[model samples]
Target: MAVDLGQFDHPSWLTVAGTGLGYALILAVLTLTMFIVPWLVFSAL
Candidate 1:
């Protein structure tokens, strides 16, 4: 199940910039959590 966003192009640079930052932030958080949880549990004695 998915909702289509239609077009991928933006009308201006501001929108593109904002979206790029938002995507990066989301990716960073997901990646950090994915690795951190395992490391934390494995290292804890």
Candidate 2:
């Protein structure tokens, strides 16, 4: 499910920017949680 913006030049970048940012944010949160949970559990012990 990729976005195809090859036809449009300027607007293509604009549309993808928001979606890219959102995807990046989600990835960051998931990655952080993976490490944080393990650290918290070990520290508690």
Candidate 3:
């Protein structure tokens, strides 16, 4: 069942931008850690 979107107020530009930036930063952190941890462990040899 699809919910009605029109019933809710649309997000403002700042709200949308903030959400996008938040997700991007979180993804970047996870990606960086994924590579960094392995590199550190392997380089210790």
Query: What is the lDDT, from 0 to 100, of the residue 3 in candidate 1?
Result: 69
- Candidate RMSDs in order: 7.7, 6.1, 4.9
| Root mean square deviation (Cα) for candidate 1 | 7.7
Every candidate's lDDT: 0.83, 0.87, 0.86
Off by over 4 Å in 3: 1-11
lDDT of 3 by residue, 1-45 (tens): 999867556668668888999999999999889998889989998
Ranking by TM-score: 1, 3, 2
Best candidate per lDDT, number? 2
lDDT of 2 by residue, 1-45 (tens): 999867667876777998999999999899879998889989999
Q: How close is candidate 1 to the true structure, as a TM-score?
A: 0.61
Q: Judging by TM-score against the true structure, name the best candidate.
A: 1
Worst 10 residues of 3 by lDDT: 5-14
Scanning candidate 2 in windows of ten residues, the lowest lDDT window is: 5-14
Give the candidate order by descending lDDT.
Answer: 2, 3, 1
Task: Name the candidate, 1 or 3, with the larger lDDT value.
Answer: 3
lDDT of 3 at 15: 88
**Candidate 1: C-alpha lDDT:** 0.83
